[model samples]
Target: MQLAQLLIFLILFPLIAAFFLFLAKRDLDRAWIVKLSALTIGIVSVYLLISTYDKGGLMVSGIPAEPTGMIMFILEMLIALAILYLGIVHKKWLVVALIIIQSAVMLYFELVYAHAIHVQSNLFIDEFSNILALIIGIIGSLICVYSLGYMKFFHEHHPEMPDRRPWFFAVMFVFIAAMFGLVFSNNLLWVYFFWEVTTLCSFLLIGYTKTEEATNNAFLALWMNLLGGIAFAVAIVYLAMFGNGIMGLDELLASGKIIALIPAALIGFAGLTKAAQLPFSSWLVGAMVAPTPVSALLHSSTMVKAGVYIIVRLAPIFQSTFTGYLIAMVGALTFLIASGIAISQSNAKRVLAYSTIANLGLIVACAGIGTYEAIWAAILLIVFHAISKSLLFLSVGTVEHRIKSREIDDMNGLIVRMPKIAAMMVIGMAGMFLAPFGMLISKWAAIRAFMDAPYGFVFVIILVFGSAMTLFFWAKWMGKIIAVTSDGKNIEGEVDHSEWAALVSLAGLSLITTLVFPLLSTKLLEPFLMENYGHVAQLSQDNIIIMMMMLMLLVILPLSILIPTRKHRHVSPYMSGRTTTHDMRFSGSLGVQKKTVLSSYYLTEYFGEMKLKTAGIWLCSALIGIMFVATALQGVIL
Candidate 1:
């Protein structure tokens, strides 16, 4: 198939599938429709990856440019109007104001300033976009399949709430479609159009419950993302009016040296907001109120990835400038503080949410550094983080359904209760922070890149401490899941097949990607860096050997646990001669029986969100202010 035809298929197929999903009434019909859609998308995405590899990136240009622009403008306006209605209905004055201002700026630009802009290439596909597509298609489809089982339980648990399953499924598919368009779009306005689509989809998904809390959180997300939308509009205006009227990414990147810093800073600011860096991070934390599939989608592949995707795409423009330094500082600080905060979270979903934000910050920092090595690290982080985080979220959701809680304290002896999910969770958690996992490998690469960059010492220090905090939080969770007291009742049969299929597939992917790290680095990462940056940063053979050794350990350790062993006598814990024989209880002085209890140390007093949130927010807000001021000063001098 031609590249243009493939792009059209990828961009529109999901929307068509979403329509059918919405129209389907029976559960059996919905299941078949979703499975077929996911299967088709997955197959096409793999084909695109292979095609891109063989052809070495594809560009479609110079056709339907005018009509595309008009269509995009109309769609954008419609989105704004919908948001306006939502804000007014909810009595959210700030949201209404932000949307109006953003829409006005966009209209002025589209009607007046943007007339001179002609995007030579409306669609550009490269290794970067191919990676993102793979993520969206594969991980995203798995999440959808998982939701088939999850939403059933969701409705069962909330029997009083109306079943909005069709709306949920339709919106999820639309989110996937928008992501495809966002990643492949070369025109700035087209990117913005798809960007707003994601923000709208997230608003609908987050507020799917229609409860007071869900509605408020959804509006909060809307306004924050609208802030980014406003910045994105300003960027277009700045580019069109002051920067040679170039509005396509190819043109902007090709002429990055001469392009104004103000626009770059504006776009970078938008990325920060979309990625939920510090001051704007509360929305994502609150997003845990949504269903697990929604959280998995937002954190893993679609919503937040769109944010970093834009920033990473524009890395060359901001590299080594004042704007770049500030971006790096904000990302590093977010990484550090968010990791610290995760240490205090007992809620499983919140822990995953904070981890997602922190990892994204690291990716943003790498983009800000904007060297060949840093870009490599950033891309690897995107890929690895998507797989592992999606797995973790799904695992947590399944656990929550079975245990009826998302609190870490409630998951005591999870292995004994839900052995299959507990094992999957262990793999997911290990992939997050342990050696031989893709995330840790990427972090190691990021540390190396930082050490060689301009602000080497400071960034390296932050990376070290932040990584230690990551280990602390993830290890505690791992211990909670794997801690076995007795052979508890198993729940292997209770989980749906669809849920198990997604979970087990993701688990395999997390490990398989780590095993193939070297090949992945050589084929995808190396070629991408060389093509884009004109050089490849070599990974030491020694590191590859170390990864191999760790892979061996990963394989062996699991088999050691699963394989049958010689039976041995078990004994209860000795409690200073007061221990009971049956349940490991200890006798009290008053002859009252007591059961022993164990809990994970959250260290809330030191690492609590209350203690750290205000400071982190203010510090990041100040850094963002300095960033724009410096950019403005540079614009003045230029």
Candidate 2:
């Protein structure tokens, strides 16, 4: 009962808080309500995870007895209407067209055909749901706490701007609530409802700042996600009509039809858009214009995770189909492209954003690989990436606030000005680098998963190349941050208490999560895999020991580098045959000094937004078109 109530609280609390928050928007004193509400949700989340430990499977609610096909048809009509309203308000005709077509399809499913309903299960709490709930509850809570600090600075930065904290925090919290609903739901239609709610919440949050740029980016996000939503609605409607009108995920999974591969791939396409896989990657990058905490919460910990979560959950059905190869190709391409682009970026935030897309691409690729080890790798990546990426974003925000810039060149010698925050940044960066850490552990697993597959060697090649690119981009940024003057003085900076709190908390969490990984694997992850996939394999004890030893060596070796740096006299960087002065300026012949500026090579000729947008849009459209044709062909082929 506590678990049931915990689930209820997780869903309803944020909704109730959103109403009250909107009501209290005019008063500054009500700001504390945001923090209080998030804390309550967090507490409930922890309680739910704990209560479910000794419990195996708990059903919270029963589905309505009405025929699910009729029910889905009705719900879809309402969704279409809601979307039409959005289109009219936003003046987006493309959304209007999309909704109209989806409505037409639903009409046919409802009136032209009749299908029998089958009832199997209602609401459920399995180990997978529990783990996702923990992620949403724990990491989502931390993001909220971090937001309190971040939003405060944001308001100070834009003092003349209208106060929108209520709407912002309300939407952010509701997003968390919706995610809880999504993962916990056994009813496919119920999950779909929650899914649409998340789409709405993300649309609102992405446009939180309401600048022209913010609104435009938000619209792009809206349209792209709507494309996915349409695909989801179509899949749900088909399942309701033909496959026993059940609309419960467990029933669908057990139905045993290759035709289900159609929806699986379509769902994966949705994940791609939401995960910001290349081609659709711009929406997440554009999302960076919002305040820092939103970026941290949405991109790092929550919204993006939802995309891959759906894909990973559906992996069993699609693994043996041609759709699997298609998915692997999409993921591998996204990984390679994003990593290559990240190499050319000078903006620290852009680097992080592209890296996120790249990592998510790798996760999606692992899901396509679909071995037990592959699924394990994907889940591990989700956890560790959440920790380190959120820390890095928050730290960067604090640094930008102090230094008045987001460029890496401006951050040179940051260790001199704000040593503690800089150290946190370095730690976060190192944690993300794919070697001797959680991220690397997952990458290695992914490589093995791909290599074991028949005719999957190409994916392995792409994965390896992407890994090298990732290393280069991250190392370049780290080196730039610590680059110093010939005289050896550190760069100077300062930050407030709120900034310090967020940075320290996230940094500490990243390290702690890594330490407890073995426990997480055995108790939380393995059970879920065994329940779903069957036949769990134990990781070699020797491999685990080697990783631990490597980590210990990192601790000892870094100390040596630090010790020598403090004692040795600093000297100028090597310059070719020219005696130079003024740090990065070298004397040319005849008394002229040439300034040597350090900036990343942003291969605009290849990866620039202007150069690639047209081609990407065309390819995305073509890929989506092929998906629809293939989905319809399922009926004919099977």
The numbered model that scores best in TM-score is 1
The sequence of per-residue lDDT tens digits that candidate 2 reaches over residues 487-516 is 433333335454566577777776667766
Tens digits of per-residue lDDT for model 1 on 448-559?
8898887688999999999999999999888887776555688768899899989989988988988888988888878878878888977789989988998889866545
Q: Roughly what TM-score does model 1 have, to 2 decimal places?
A: 0.98
Error of 2 at 156 (Å): 2.2
